[model samples]
Target chain A: MNRKKLLSGVLAVCIAAATALTSAACAKKNNKDSGGDTAEVKKLFVDLHTLMPSASENATPDQPHPVNASRYIAAAYKSLTGTEIVWASDYAKPTDNINNISAWFNQQINIKNCPAIGFTFGTKMQADGLYADLGEYLERPNPYVAGNTRWKDIFEDWVWDDPAVTDANGKIVSVPIVLHPGSATAIYYNKDMFAENGMTVPTTWNEFIKTIDDGKKVPGIKYPYVPYTGDTGISLSSWAFRYSLSPGFAAHMADRTDYDKNGIVSTNELIRAVLEGAFNPNVCQEAKALYRLAYNYYKTVLPGGWESITDTTYLNAWDEGKVAMKNQGLWYYTNEKSDVIRKFDFDLFAPPVAQSDSSAYASDLPRKKLSEGYRSQVLISFNVMLPAVSGNEKLLEKAIDFLMYLSAPEAVTAMVQENGAGLPAVKGAEYPSVYDDSAWLDREFTEIGISEWPLGFIEGNTANINAAFSDWVFGEKTEAEFFTIVNREQVNGARTMVNNMKINTAGWNI
Target chain B: MKDGKKRKIQIKYIIAAALVSVFSLFYLFDFLWAKTYKVEVVSVSDENPVASNGERVEIAVRVTHFGKPANGHVIFALPSDGRMLAFTTLTDENGVATLTYIPYTANAFLPVHDVEIRIRDQSNSIFWEINAYTDLELKMRAR
Candidate 1:
């Protein structure tokens, strides 16, 4: 009995010790993740690619990792996925204006070999069949985005409508990482000149133009306003001038809506009316009012010698304080510190409503409040794609899986803040104050303005449109001649757009 | 006394004396030699981040010894009578010591500045003398 009692005590002790150790281990494992045991994770072998080659590519054995933004992203990705990213520095940035990343696809680098690719807003070889039809991949539920929200639903719908991203079949071919492609025009006024002349930033459109003419009276002011007509990208005050003249043109340009059926007479319907000869230059009351407004813009507002100067010259003249007011985009003067010093501590100017009478339009323009038409169209740019060359039966899904990780809103926004020059398409991206101001992102297009999309669509591009518009501004083209040319240009694009209208059948019936 | 009895007592006394001496020497050597430690002020960019007055700023620090992460508690001695986010904090597994500093006012004159740091022993006593240098700058401008 004594031996049996002793054996029982030893057995109890051993069991207690084992139970204590198992409980301790279970506790340690539970502590590893605070959220839950629902830690579903996948391993990735495909390397993260970058737009620029890693700086350490050609290093002579004594180099640290390339200190660019991609390196940080690679580190974060490894932490998330437990995989190493391959840095291909031999594939450098676009040399001689040729994108080597795209060239690789053209070169037919095996899709299994090409992991991840990034490029700016331009020709993405979608037509060449080099790009994967990313719509299905984007539509899949993103594992990173907390719950059921698909990746496609993250960005604004209007972004995919860009004629650049949509193929002939009306499918969105790319996934954009950065949104702000081009800059919106804002007035930068010389504070010293304004203070000296007792001139304040104008609230009304007529006063704003009058201030420009009156600003020359300030000391050392030659051209009171620097309008760089030579810059083809700039539409010679088109934001304030042209957009205000006709608001909401892009929305209804190809809409199949009938007039008099609805209260809202869209800008495109009015353009269609003009095309149908409903608004002529001379005879019709509506046509005469529109013509008179265009006449006043050319005659009174435009600087006579603007067509002679180049964009660089105009900006240089502004920098020297030879001008009182200069208008440019957020990206125009990148170095804010020097721009403020050179331009006499300039301040932002709110644009006054276009002084052109909206009531004069019998269907040409919308008679709306300044607040209703105050927004600007932001150019959504940049996309990353898993090329179609990687057949789905193969590791295309794996490449796409890695892409989903890299392009997660959190991941992409971090990259934009660290590396990209413009705004992020992902929500909650904080602007680095050193590079950009948070306020410049705010602006609403009062009118549904047409993008420079057709310029990319039409064969020869926007230079022709730029030259023709410049000619009209300088009287190189007569009023009758300019109207005829612009009208013909729109009619030509309308044919192609109307056909694609079948595939993208949902939006505004256009 | 018998010879055997005397020999036994002598051996016991000798063994006791050697043990006392060995213990004294062991403690003395511990008091004499010093262990090496490494503390680095991580490189920060020119946008020396500083919060506007009435706001706060947090900075992280790392502690290491013999090329390995140094664990346990650490104390930071801030410059200009400035206080730390924590008077005392423990180092993470990676040896990162997060220390926050809030300036009542922003001074851009010297963007780069320094903070002093040291390690504490198990009993929370200062175990090491700190190496001081200008590794930090007040690059933080008034927001």
Candidate 2:
């Protein structure tokens, strides 16, 4: 009887001890205060490290227009948690945009005090696994939202899952903040000139050229459309190409091509096709047509001295009302209202490239109307990257919280309103109804304008095409000569891309 | 003979104690392992933080899990009067929900009004916005 009593006493004691131990372990695992965790809440001090492209002539003489979202983001976390944010902009000046590699990876990645969140065009940091894989966090519900919605549900469909942010293994490595998919290749015209000239907005290609021809006689304006060709051969080619690469014409490749089939033919796929022996530039029907279109623009449509007019020259001329219209990108509107000379109102329209005569459709060029939004390429720029660092989990969490806050509908609306640029990547964002006395760009942009260079195509494609177009447009090369130059460049560009991709040598033609 | 009988009784006691102890351990496991949750809710919108009475203010409320979305039901105890518009709504998959409320009977920029919005099980005041003309509105309510 004594033995039994002693055993019972021992069992009860063991039970009590085990219960106590389990409770301690659970307490440690739970992210709650629970009486024992008395460590006072640590205030977060996060720095936003990023770079802004140096303005050509300074968009603002005394103060830069607010382009960074960090200012609005400053309020979001403060309202919720105890966080002190430092906006550390342009940390690496020299390497800010060194051919797409930013200062964040060039110098800041190694420093212990590097900004918590950074803006970069992908670098060794991302490709070499030095950046955090944001795949998990992007999926979690955003705390900034006052409802039970996951973060994954908030982003626009195409941008949230864009292939550009993913690595070779399909792991999402970054977050895309801005997707400028609309027409960068738009005609920002002097709306006052067009209005006074009694000219209606031209919906057809033939009508557009008529206005260009008519502008020469419109009292003050000398050139109706002055594309920025200057001494830069690349600029001329780009100017001509934007009007040439319509969606109807863009699908034709130099070699057989395979796009993402996500309905977006991004630059990454173009480069991949070039390297993988899936695309070749030499015999591409689209390339030939695009070249012809550029040649035609220089021959008939471009203003004289287009060979000499740098973009700045035309922009200055536009302010003085000397130039009536110019083919530029969406970036022109992002500048401050004070930057312009303010002689006339400005409006934007897509590049008009089709032949007026239905009979002139002898080539693979599109026979469709010019106003249709057929884009040749989709431009997805300015993604936010989170670098991989050790032992700063709390700070990292806070930075992510800020990013999520920026992705909200209200935040996106503010960004579009303040920055006056950048198509919001968040769904349900509001684009300002009007821009500078003119309406906003077409929601369904008319032309998927071609880029200046065949961006991310065969390696030598950019240089070779630029030279060919320069000689052709400058009256230095004959039609035969231009064709000869282009063919040679196409061959060389493909070979360069092959070497860059490091394909093993075989029976393949170089 | 007495000692042998005592020994048998002791064995029975030990067996009974062991069974009772094992059952107690199981009970402890169940108590600690079962899931339990309490939502933390807050206002997330910085835009239109202040609104006039009778002016519909879209109140955004979020139930969070440690600053992230907490997936669960959040029932709200609405103000009894018609002033509490859209008193019940569920957070979406991202822990975000928006409801429009008419806090006053008429629209005009008036004095500030403090409204304490609550989630039924203790937590409240998830969102606070202005109700101008509060005194006049209160007079109408009193009548």
Candidate 3:
């Protein structure tokens, strides 16, 4: 009886000690002061590093409009936060790897004496556990969170859950500031060349192949079609696969698939078909086609390309009597608006959709994730983060307010008027005027629009896609061989991505 | 001989006097017979003399001859720029003229001054003018 009593006494002491330690671990920091003025809030510092294309020494003033994502985001954030933000611009840095970034972050954090929010194209820091868990902010009512009803409601219902932001891991880590939607890949033929030879837009996969083959029979033309090789080539060919595999891609992402489901059909067959259809002999056949089409189309249509050409020259071929079309994004409006090309009086339209009962039309898939261009090639693309460095509540509030402003009709109108950004994620913001001055482009989309989701932006899916594309384009792999590699890569990459992403599924009743 | 010379000079003076009298009568008839016209101007909303804050200002002008209304081009000009702002027509039968001028907010970048309306007719070589003023006093409501 005495031994039992001693054991009970020891257990009680142990319980007390455990409770004391637990309390200490869970203790909240004293964020508030007696005066209610509060503790000195630390300033959150952020660095928006972005790439800008530089002009060559002999380049004319008409260089391509460089994407200043960081600048626009910073302006909007500053307008909303009303915080005096100090910024540093890093020009022409090629390597976007997280390890390279971590070194920069460590250096900045130590020197600046502030917890830094590195506003990058991806969640490199967050995946590394260098950034805060934005999950807490999403749980509470916060405007910066993308999927919140108050905020996400402003965007189209389709975009609210664009696959770009929702990877296989189901977490949105980077915030896409500018979202370029639809496959910018379209077959642009020499209008005069096609007209002189009697050609039209191909609607079916079979027609597409036959047309290219027929074009090659012409004596003067080098190849019926040319396609980009290496990275560029793969991206273009991938679009062909993307459209063909749209239904399965959408189905699998919708969480309707089983583990045993082989969603991909004829992955290798499709790759071989695109390669054969392209009809170009060279490795970088696509880009060469673009350049050739520009020159040939210019000789007939526009008076200009007789001189050396720039990127605008490629776009002008479509407008100024060169090429009949070019596969590019809606933001190609900027390219069309270029001083020399503006005379062409261009129009916008969606690429032809392969007939599918299961695939949702592009118009139906309203929401798009703003992913980086390179990565979105393989996986989902989107933007999904808020900067944590500013630390100023007002700044954060203002940033949220700017997003709210983005939802406003006036803000959308301004963006459209400037021809600055691409599609807005908001509902009712879709209008004909958003694309071209013509009602036809708008009408075309209305007639045949399909549901679309932007790919994941933050994670390493971009690298995976690029790798897969490289193997398909340059590597000596059969169509079956290429697809096998692609599927394996997707499965392995997806698992790693989900493991890194911390998803918050609160209030998701569905 | 002197008497005969004086009589001839008197005949020449009489011929010169007759020509001057005819020219004076012609000038008087032309001035008195020229066409004259008046323009009647009013706001579209009779109940409102002043524009409701953020509302458009509607002005109407009419032209008539011998109490029968006429229809032709009417030029409306603003006092600030002295450029014709708008051109419209009077009703074919009623000769009623109307144009809307949206009032600007005090903070907005629009000229605040008197607006002028002028009407001209090719049928009678007659023209008429009218003027209206807006103070632009209040803050506008959010759009």
Please provide, for model 3 over A142-252, each residue's C-alpha lDDT reduced to its tens digit, 9 standing for 90 to 100: 354445554444444343233333333334443333343433443435555676778765654335545655665665554454331111333322443445324323332
How are the candidates ranked when ordered by TM-score, highest leading?
2, 1, 3
TM-score of each: 0.52, 0.54, 0.46
lDDT of 3 by residue, B1-143 (tens): 69999999999999999988876666555434234444556444422323222244455656566666765533232312111112223344566656443322221112233333233332343221222212211222333
lDDT by residue (B1-143, candidate 2, tens digit) is: 69999999999999999998887776655443221223433442322334322234445555554455644333343332223333344556776555444332211111233443443321222222111110111112210
> Judged by TM-score, which candidate is best?
2
Point out the higher-scoring one by lDDT: 2 or 3.
Answer: 2
Report the Cα lDDT for residue A136, model 3.
Answer: 36
TM-score of chain A of 3: 0.53
Q: What is the DockQ for all candidates, taken in turn? A: 0.02, 0.01, 0.01
Best by DockQ: 1
All-Cα superposition RMSD per candidate? 22.6, 26.2, 23.9
**Candidate 3 chain B, poorest ten consecutive residues by summed lDDT:** B77-86
CAPRI-style grade of the A/B interface in model 3: incorrect
Give lDDT tens digits, candidate 2, residues A1-510: 699999999999999989766644432322121112233223322332232322331212133332433443554556566554444432333332333344444444444334445544432233334456677888798886668367867766555334445533345555555545354456678788888888766544556768778887788886677763322443333534544433334543422333446544444444444445443334554555555655666676776656666667676777787777776655554441323235567667766554323113212333323125332231332333344233446545655676787667656555554344445566666543323223444334543322122333332354565666677777777766766665555446545544544434353332
- Lowest-lDDT window of 10 residues in candidate 2 chain A? A28-37
Per-residue lDDT value at A178 in model 2:
53
